[model samples]
Target: MRTAICDMLGIELPLLAFSHCRDVVAAVTNAGGFGVLGAVTHTPEQLEHELAWIDEQVGGKPYGVDIIVPEKYEGQGEALSLDDLAARIPPEHHAFVDRLLREHGIDTTDRAELAGRGMNISDRIGERLLDVVFRHPVKLVANALGVPPRYMIDRARAEGVSVAALVGAKEHALRQVEAGVDILVAQGTEAGGHCGEVTTMVLVPEVVEAVKDVREVPVLAAGGIVTGRQMAAAIALGAAGAWTGSVWLTTEEAETAPYTVRKMVAATSRDTVRSRGRTGKPSRQLASAWTRAWDGPDSPGTLPLPLQSLVSEPALRHLDTLAEKGDRGAQELATYWVGQGVGLMNRVRPAKDVVYEIAEDFAEAAERLTGAIGD
Candidate 1:
């Protein structure tokens, strides 16, 4: 449908797909839906190459970028490099993770070798990413965790790109609008990745009313929104559009781990849990041994932000590698970020097809609503 987001972003539909796969992003954009690439883990060099590749594929079609810039995290403001952040990770946390893996039948002998740079949530990396973003034909940029930084907002403004931010609470939405965010994605606990406790059904309307007097900004409903009918429902809740992620994880073009994708396809809405085991912040993911161990009695507990990733990424990466090789223990521990809508995503489809399906569903739902009204 023609909503404010469609007009603002020069797209035919107000559907914004948040995906890490460049293929999915380009496909969605070409299908008349906006695609926002998640770059929290990408280096500047990597993001530049991705945006360049998307530029070639979309042929001037508008797309967006998502970066994590949490307001608070371990070693935040201390000029900590990735190495520094890793060093800050307590030995107890490392030992706990190793023991947890060992208990699950995973070999932890090469634990050091499995280490990888986790998410780039610091200003140092974010500033560099912004430089790469402006260097491409990116249409919008969003801070996945908190308010967009001054440099990010300024650079986007100078380049005429719209700025968006994801918020879980009404207060956060108000703060984002006051910070000059062009759009607000009211993400609820049902969403993947880091999220708050509110449900989307309640959060969207709360956010819409909270920011109405502060400024005129389109609110996009996110969390458990995987179909066109859900987008129509979001619009009914005062959202100008819908911001979706989990549904695309099952798409043919997705970068989700093979085993995890299979798990997602078979998962029910109740199978997901908001566990802080991965990111040190409550993020919705499939309930697995990894999450359970972290919440167990013998756990060292999760660390803050980037530091927690240090504890999780290496082990999770190892689990994924082994799970693909048919290790039962690894498979049981392997989980990925996904929303409760995994229940509705039963099949893998092409990204373009998914976009069109959503559009058609939205139309049918809208028409049904129109006909229901007593004329």
Candidate 2:
């Protein structure tokens, strides 16, 4: 299980769990893997509070933080208020969302009230959150959508923290290394959340070979890596570790909506789709009525980045609430970001059990591989 990443991050297992839920992060970290908190959705105050709570739970175990600062978006570099961002979304898009919900017999009375509460997709907001993150004792800070902002890199270095970036292509990996990132997460399209159209099997090695001459940076294979066998495969492909997100969604400590978790547990690998309906960026999520409605031929086209969030988040939030209340239509429409590996995640286990099981499986896989090679 030893690798350069383990040495750098001071973690036992090379598995890095990314989750929005602090409980999942702490549980994984406590169980011997590195836990990275997805802080893109948290406000500065919320991030500060969550980090403090995680610090208390992990008892000095190393952890990381992930923030999204997309390279391109609707209002890049603008200091627009949430209300201003919401105003930029077209009225037709709003109508289209309402029509979709009504067609499914879901009520949308409080939909307007739910707007403007989406995750921060702007660099400006990310910087503010970074201010809060550097104040904490986090061992790593990651930028998910694009290169890490210069301020983020400089601040992390000043605070003695490592900087990581997620990339979907070899060129992106090279760009990150040239930008001085300490770690690169080669995330394939099968990954949940915003991703490009490259498969993990191809992207991992491509990135590894591409970045070797640039610098000896650690590459963590991500996207659809749920099992220890997959982790082993990633290592065989020249990855130093695995950066996982989807598997944690079905864990007992996950903050995923109850209805969404049920859907993920029952889902097959073929049951997901990469669509821009959710985030205006291609993210692999459960293929539900919601995604279908947006992707259908008659639907209005999606917006870009934060603008698309303005259109989708309110409706999705309402659907989650209704689904929780046992509305059949809402339940059918309930979906969350998950990788193709979800087909294998059929049960809800504790986060610690997941970490231990993955470690054991990885060991067994390695033993089998070694045994295959004759003396």
Clashing pairs in 2: none
Candidate 1's TM-score: 0.98
Candidate 2 residue 228 Cα shift, in angstroms, is 0.7
Say which candidate scores most in lDDT. Answer: 1
So what's the TM-score on candidate 2?
A: 0.98
Tens digits of per-residue lDDT for model 1 on 247-352? 9999999989899999999999998899889999999999999888888898888899988987798789888889999999999999999999999999999999
Per-model tally of clashing residue pairs: 0, 0
The 10-residue segment of model 2 with minimum total lDDT is 107-116
